[model samples]
Structures are given as structure tokens and as C-alpha cells.
Target: MSTLTTPHRPSGAAPHRPYRPSGLTWTVLRLHRTALYVWGAALLAAVAALIWLLAAGPDARAIVGGCDASEPFPIDCGTAHWTTTARIHASGLALVSACVTFQIYAVAVWAGAALTGRELESGTARLAWTQSVTPARWLATRLAVPAVLLTAGTTLAVLLLNWTRRAGRGDLSGGWFTMNVFISSGPVAVGYALAGLALGALAGLVLRRALPAAAAALAAAYVLHEVLDGFRMSLWPAETVTGRAALQLPHGTLVLEHGAVTGAGERLSNNMACVGTDSAAALERCVERTGLTDFWTTYQPESHFWPLQLVESGLLLAVTGLAAAAAFALLRRQHS
Candidate 1:
């Protein structure tokens, strides 16, 4: 047998990474089991319950009977609804609750905040990170699963909400559901996970102890998540002059300073309509102030879904990127 001598490969650049799945992912999945179950299972549970309610509940028309003809705002039922105002709002609220404003996003960010910050404190995460896996990659892959699952969960939850909302669209009160729910891989969701992940990764890489980090991450993320995500927009109420008793816009953040109103008969410079829910809200504040044709009483308050999601998510992602980079940099410098 002639042994052919193969030429040694010259080193110029690293070879392309093979398409095989990284076994590191298994470690991530293993590390993230509790967090996933807590967030994912809870979300799935909520969705399943929603599905059941939607499937089992009375049809919208049956509940509605002939309420479209009433005063305030009426749809095409055209017969002048005889129902009381309370019943109108009650019936309309089913659709309202399905909105991102009302339920899905509310549940998701809160749920994610809960999931991300608690891992290290429990002494659970370090079991994997101490191995060949770098702490940054470990944290990233761990967070990636839940973020993905929750994003899909939000999308599906919103879809189901849409399905329920569609059933009642013949009624104007039901139109709130017709508006899209803006939960995507958007900044808010990413920010939420990042909030947790950053805090946790910081704890893991810096503190080297999971429990303290987990507890602190969860507590801090919990306290700050909404404030940060909404950028204090949701924290304060934006007074309207009662042209209509419009619910505050989700994308249109209102800040309230008690006993402050403008001389021009406007609510206040900061408290009223400073941020309207427009598609352009995604751009920097220098881009636009007022929203599009979205803030009218003819529609529900949360018609601008995407902008809110984008703003919150954008802030989160920005912070997350910075945080991950910082963690990676810190870990690289560690003596261990």
C-alpha cells in the first residue's frame, strides 16, 4: 500500500462551521427547563383556556341579540339597540380583553420577566455554565428558547384573540379586536428576556453565584420591566378633554403631573397626546410626535399595536445587546 502524503492545510481563515446542530443547545435546554416550564407552560395554559372559552362560549350574535342600534356608537344592526349601556360595554369587553393592550402582551412581558431573573439565584444555572460552555453563550442559548417560545405564544395568543374578535365584528363594540395585537420579536419582548438574561448573566459571570443574581435579576426586572418597556408612558395618565371618554392609547404614552394643565386649553404638554400611536413611532422621537388617524373615538384606544411593541422591544433589544456585550467582555477578562 503506497502511503500518499497529503499536503498540510495552510492556515488563512477558519473553515465554515458545519450545518449540524450545536450540541451546546442540549445544555441550554437542560439548564432552562424550569424557566421554560414556568413561562411556556403558563402561556400555553392561558392560550388553551382561551381556546376553550372561545370554543364553548355563546356565539357573539346570540349574546349581542340586537344591540347595534343603541346610542353612543352603533354598528349595522340598524334596529336601535334596546340594551342598557352596561351590557354594551360588557359584551364589547370580550374583544377588548383579547387585545395586546389588555391581555397577551401584559401576560407575556410579565411572564418573561419572571422567567429570566430567577435562574441564577436558585443554584440551577451554573450546573451547565461551569463546563466547556462559555457563560455568555450559555445564557444566550438558554434565553433564546424561552424568548422564541414566548414570541410564538404571543403571536398565537393574539391570533386567537383575533379569531374571537372576528366573531363580533358586526358590532362596533367588538371592533377593538379587529385591531392587531403588536407582540412580535419586537423590542419589548426581547427587552423583557434581555432584562432577565442580562441581569442573570451579569450575576453568573460577575457574581459567580446564581441565587443572589437570580433573586436580584427577577426583582429588578419585575420592578423595572414595565417602567422601562413603556418608558414611563404607561405609568402616567394622559388627560383627554372628554371629547370622548376614550381609553388611553397604548402606543400614545401619557405622562401626568398632578395639577398641571396648559393655558391653550390642552391637557398638558407632557400629559396629553405627546406620543400618539403612529407607525412612525418606531422612528426616533425626533421623527414624529402625533399619531396617525389612529387616536379617534370611532375606534378602540389601542389601535396602534405595532408602534408600542416596537418602542418597547427596541429599547429592550438595545439594552440587551449592550448588556450581552458587556457580559461577554467581562467574562473574557475574568481570571478564571
Candidate 2:
């Protein structure tokens, strides 16, 4: 044979790298490709709807606006096309809003069940550790990848939502503090998503089972959110507008409490239902019957929107940090 001996490699030549199923980041992406696809599809759908709304928004506004000022309202406009357009836009907004609102729970379930628990249950995570990847590194990669994706996706969705809301600003009737509007319109959405991911990962590390971990994570997230929602109003001080008579709060004011005030300054919130009665006599009787003198209203102005959102976002991010720290600590303990 001309060369029976093995070919000699150069002294300084690099050795061929061993094959792996995939790199860490690529593995995470590949494993959760279904979720990625779903996320992408949602974004695409929202973008498409928003683009259509932007195009149709002006025409819809004009059609509704063109109505005789004396007419009843949109119903009196009598254009089927206008009705259809408005309905479509409203439905689009509802769909997108629901997605944003539910993202926290969705992310929690996925992180708990698919991202961590399933791998642990099947011994895949142990396998990864034996393949020259440290436990911390693997866990870090898992959380980091999803965190980046969540942030990017949520940010985009919020921007798109803000744009769409602005497009329909003339017709959209709600204060900024409204739950759906508040969550979908600001950076707090990102905070909620990340918190969900961290809490889910913690749940996964603890449970090490798919269904149970997912359920636990979801319940935990819901409880935390409910608690947070309860404290939202207290995050910032409300502006009080008091007057000797019924006060006309500025448009877009988020009235926390409005009621007639007695001479002793006691706020009687339960007594205001009759103030706006169709019958003038009934309104007078209600006001006089209550012996109310001054009126006071506590509210959040439009300017308070960002302050409230930022505070709530900060609290959520703080929770995320704690959850992530717990998960890493738990993993470290187990690895040791």
C-alpha cells in the first residue's frame, strides 16, 4: 500500500470539535420552536390588524364624524360599511388586548412545563450537564434566551398597541388606567412576562414534573398578580378635586372615588347614584335628602399614567429578580 500509515496532522492544527445536538442557545430555540412560531404568528396577526386599522381609521372617523351633530350617534350614521369597519377594529383590539393580558399566564405555563420541567422529568437536563455544560450555565442560558425573546416581543406588542390606540383616539372611550389599556399600553407588560418566566422556572425546578409544575406556576402567578392589582391604586397619590357643588372632572380622569361631602367633610360615595338621574326632581331630592353640601373627587389624572405604570413595573421586576435568584439557588443546591 502506498500510505498504510495514518496521515500525520500538523503540530499546531486545531482539533475537530465534537458534535452536539445543538449549541445551548440554538438548543433552547429549537426545543421551543413551537412557542416561537406561535409568538411570531400572534405578532404578525396583530401587526396586520393594526396596519389595516391605521388605513381604515381615518375613513371610519370621518364617516362617524360626518353624521349630523343632531343625530343620535353612530347608530344614526346608517352606513353599513362604517359599522363593519368599527366592529372589525373593535374585535381586533379585543383580541390583541386579551393576548397581552394573558401573556403572563401563558409564559408561566410554558416556562414551567416545557422549558424546565419536561427536560428534568425526562433526564434531559442531567444529560446536558454531563455533556460539558455546567448546571448554572445551562440554567442561565435557558432563562436568558426566553427573557430576551419575551422582552422583545412584549415591547413590540406594546408599541403596536399604543399606535393603534392613538389611531382610534377619537373614538376609544376609556381612561388610561383601565386594566386592558394600562397593561397593553406600557412597559409593564414586559415586566409581567418576565415575572411569569422567572416564577415558572422556579416552579419547574421545584416540581420537576410537567403538568403539576405548570398548574402550580399558573396559580402562583395569578395570586401574585391579583395581589399586585389590589395595591395599584396606592402606588401613587390620587389628586383630590373638591368643590362646593357637583364638580366636572376633566376628561380621561380616573375617578377613584367621587361622592357628595357633608358639612363635616364625610365622603358619602353611596349617595351619588341619584345625582345623575333623568328626573330633575329626583336629583334634587337625592341631593337634598342626603344633606350634602360640598362634593369631592379623588382621581388619577392622565399625567399619572406613567407614574403608576413605572411603579408597578418596578415592583414586578423586583419579583422577577427574587424568583430568578431562588431558581438559581435551588439548582445550585441540587447540583451540589
Candidate 3:
């Protein structure tokens, strides 16, 4: 009877469950809670701004529309109303898109300084390595977690941005080819952010110092951005149109190379004779004098937006993979 008896518990007492911590994911999240919060707040702010702009768009457009019929909305159009509401809408769109496009810089800097570099520099990573976690697992968790969060946040922001863009189509300052709009409007923004993360991690591994690693990461990201932007137009095949028809190409055409085409089929860009030809009659004289059979123009239409985006994103993701692989290899070599 004594062996079969069980001890009585207090009325409020509950059965104990194991106090297991949430493991590496929780650890990483806790370690970088400030950055996580900042990122979330930033995205929320961008979305909120865009939503406001979307709602106020019609009113803004109407105010501007009531102005004089100037081709470009004059600085004094509708005086205070146009200057206040319309410019505010334009500025909001510009600001949000610019922030979204350039967020990769912040991502790279944070990833390098706080995410990986600081931990390694302070020997926290070494301590983790000595514990149950391996360096590979630690690095994987760092990259993968940030990447997932970055992708989800950026993708949502971009989708909302696209919707807002549609709502304020005519009010936009520039077309789809504009740097901020182009970069922030598609999946390429996610690729850039992930690339920033990978590049930052690699920089941290290579430098092992927070400040220098952050600088290196920023420099690397800038170089990547500039290079990709320079080559973006060349990623997909552009349509080549010849003759007078090329001069009247549609509104959104991204004119890459426009000049005179020689009878021998040579493409001459900015032929010396046509350098300052202001009038259509003068341009015709220049083309005829330059032995040019037709005015040839190579350009990308609005339709090529997706193809260019995919190509650029593919290249960026390729960079991400290479950087991540290099970081892992460097870690193995140093630790082994």
C-alpha cells in the first residue's frame, strides 16, 4: 500500500514539462532582436506610406490635372495645391522606391558588423562552436534565417509597390526603367538583399573585424549593384528598329543605341554630323550626308521588363551562391 501511494500536489500546481529552450533559431533571433525589429518597422513604414499614397492618388492627380495645360507640370502649377499635395505624392513615391532599392546597403552593413562579424570578433561564435553547434550549422542558421525574413518582407513590399504604382501610373516621375522603380519593383530586389547578406558574411569571414568587414561588405555590394546596372540593358535581346519609324517609337521604349545605319550595315552611334541636329529636317540632312540608309535604333520595350528582371536576378543569385560557398570553404579551412 505504501509503495502504491502517490504524493499529493498543491491545488494550483501543474505537471512539469521539460524547460527546453527554442534552440539555435531562438538564439539567433534573440541575439539580433534589434535588427529584426528595425527591419520590421522599416517595412511597415514603407508599406504604410505607399498605402497612403495609393489612397490620396486620385485627389493629388485631380489637383494637378486642374492646372494649366503645360507639358511638364510647371513649378507653380495650381500654386499651393499643386506644390503641396501633388509634390508630396511624387516625393512619397520616390522616397519609398529609393529606400526599398537601397536597403541592400543597410542589410550588408548589418550582416557584416552585427550578424556574423561581431560574434566572431567577440569569441561568441567560438563559444557556440565549442558547444553543441558546429560552425557550419551556425553559419547556415545565420544566413538562412535572415534570408527568409528578408525575402518575405521585401517581396511583400515590392508587391504593394507595384499595386501603388498602378494606382498612380500617370503621376510617376519616371518610367519603369528608372533605377529606383526598376530595382524595387521586381524579384531582383530580393536577390540583391540576399546577395548582400552572403557578401557580408563572406566579408566577415575574410576580415573577422566588425568595422572593416562592414566596409568591405558595403563596397562589394556597391560594386555589384553598379556592374549589374551597367549591364542590365544587355542581358536580353533588344529590338532593333530601322528607318523613320524608329524615331516615333512608343512612349516607354528604353532607347539603348540610336544613330544612323550605314549602307554597309555598320551601326554608327551619335554620328558626328548629327551630334547637334535639333530639327527633323537637319537630322534628315545629316543622315543623307553621312551615307546612312536609315536611322537605326536598338531598344527594349516595356515587354522586356520581366526578361531583364529574371536575368539580373539570376546573376545576383549566382553571386549569392558563390559568396556563400566561399564563406563556408574559408570557415572550414580556418577551423579544421
User: Model 2 compared with the native: what TM-score?
Assistant: 0.84
Model 3, total clashes = 0
Off by over 4 Å in 1: 1-22, 60-136, 166-190, 229-305
Q: Write the per-residue lDDT of candidate 2 for residues 27-46, one digit (tens) a residue.
A: 99998899999988987887
Q: Write the per-residue lDDT of candidate 3 for residues 1-336, one digit (tens) a residue.
A: 356766898899998799977989999999999999999999999999888888887687564456655737666555655566757777888898888899889999998998889999999999999988999999999999999999999999999888887877533547888888899899999999999999999999999989999999999999999999888889999999766766677878888877876889887785434544557897788777778777767889999999999999999999999999999999999989
* lDDT (Cα atoms) of all candidates against the true structure: 0.47, 0.82, 0.86
Among all candidates shown, the one with the greatest lDDT: 3
Model 2: which residue pairs collide? none
Q: What is the lDDT of residue 11 in candidate 1?
A: 82
Q: Report the lDDT of model 1 for residue 91.
A: 47
TM-score of 3: 0.83
Write the residue-wise lDDT of candidate 1 on 141-251 in tens digits. Answer: 755665566557556655665564355332433332222223322234334544555555554555554455455555555565546544434423334433213323344
